[model samples]
Target: MMRVGIDIGGTKTQAVALADSGEIAASVTLPTMRGEDAVLATTTSSVVALAATAGRELGEFSSIGIGIPGHVDRVGGRVRNAVNLGVRSLELGPALRERFGIPVEIDNDVTAAAAGAAHLMSLSGTVAFLNLGTGLAAGIVVDGVAWRGQAGAAGEIGHLPVDPHGLECPCGQRGCLETIASGAGLRRAWPAGGAHPGRGLVRAMESGDADARRAFEGLVSGAAGCVRILALSIDPQTIVIGGGLSRLGEPLRQALGATLREWSGTSPFIADLKLPERVQFLPENTPAAAVGAALVSRT
Candidate 1:
């Protein structure tokens, strides 16, 4: 059987047709149009187009799963808010189902990504996901299921207090972890609270540029602190880091590794466990949430 999956990001929407075996038979991307029906419209059109390219009919697929960036009301299939999306109160699942006559499942994107990544890793125990793209969020898989807390606020690490009196987060918190540790966070600490020159700052860190190095260093303390805090609570066997910043490679890796030693306390419960998994960035064409969303449909 084949399923269609869509990952709707702030800037782009990606669709993939996957065999039940998890092979990508076809894929396509389109600029995301937020608000109104435009975003869902683009997704429906793209999925149909991709299915046709794969030599399959859209009706033949079992399901379409969407990983939304905002607060998804699972029961209602409505996206309530995602500040970056600038679109809210949209009925995605029903809208897509109504248009295409196929079952649609909408989920929080990070949660989907976490589920897919955990499965790909063959992670049997617990897996915690830290998503660091244009935004900061996390998702945890206990056993084989994502632990979505009450009101769906679990794994939202961006609003954690990296700075109590620092930048104001959209979540109405002061000094959110995202304000200092996300891509935008790095940009803010750059000379002008903006982006570094050239195409990608993480790549600059690879080139041994001084400013880029500083930006990463700035992230380590906060980022590592997060790991420690997570250790205290979740104690996940693996911590998977995704999104743009993980592309920084070893500079980012080494910094966090070193800080973990300092930040991880010596209490037996905290100290005696196996060394946590180092941060591993998922592949460019990764087991993303959309894939997980579709995978969920199969289950």
Candidate 2:
């Protein structure tokens, strides 16, 4: 049976209907509204749209899965503290299941992305997905299964304090890795770049904006640090980069490689890990979280 997956984000929500063979047979995208009721309405509409796109009834799909940000109670299908989406707490799973009369599953967005990346990229063994979006986090997939850790905090590397003297994070930590590498971090550092700092970063740097250059350098270093931490801790076979900052694309990849190489030059152990070779970007335009949510439904 085809599976339906929904990815809810701060700006937009995307849903996809996946065929039995794992290909997306139908999809829909819509602006995501804020608050519990609106969010639920948006999700419901997306699923309805997907069903219409595929010319099938809602009950025809085998399952419906969701990938959402913030703290997720996977078993309970609830979301909490999803600040960007204006969601404080929501019973996402039960609401959807009741609406469609199909099984519903909820997963962390990054975790869902990990599953999608592994399947879409045809990766095996342990794979780490590092999300460098408005914030930084990671998701781990072993074989085809997600490793959410004992308390479902497995990939919260963004909150790890890297600098005690650095800026305070929303998580009540100072100098967290996310404060240096994420889109929020860039906005905090380079306020002149306006709302979306990453979009104008390269141009500002090209025009010799010292602040932009510094922000970019910090982003690269922080991202490299995340990679190093993932390599040393998880020892994954591959590290897939995703999120908003990754849109910097080739320049970001090359800079990350250069940073890793520089670290390797300083430490023999780092060189032995061959981190630069293990890093890769998520394929452009792939709705990893949405596809992953679909995959998660069966599990």
Best by TM-score: 2
Task: Estimate, for each residue in 1-299, the C-alpha lDDT of model 2 and write its tens digit.
Answer: 79998999989999999999999999999999999999999999999989899999877898998999988888889999999899999999999888888899999999999999998999999999999999899999999799999888887899988888999998888999999999999998899988889899999998999999989999999999999999988899999999988999888888899999999999999999999999989988889999999998788
Instruction: Kindly list the per-residue Cα lDDT of model 1 for residues 1-299, writing each as its tens digit.
Output: 68888888877888888786877788888888867577768887878788778888777787888887877877677887766666767888888888878788888898888877877776667777788776778888787687788878787877788666788876688988887777777776665335532236666667777786676776777677566656667778887877666676666677777766554465455445433455565765674776767766544
CA lDDT for candidate 1: 0.73
Pairs with steric clashes in candidate 1: 113-289
lDDT for 90 in candidate 1 is: 83
Q: Cα RMSD (Å) between model 1 and the true structure?
A: 2.9
Q: What is the C-alpha lDDT of each candidate?
A: 0.73, 0.92
TM-score of candidate 2 versus the correct structure, residues matched by position: 0.97
CA shift of 44, model 2, Å: 0.5
Listing every candidate in turn, what is its Cα RMSD in Å to the true structure after a full C-alpha superposition? 2.9, 1.1
Superposed by TM-score, candidate 1 places the C-alpha of residue 49 at a distance from the truth, in angstroms, of 1.9
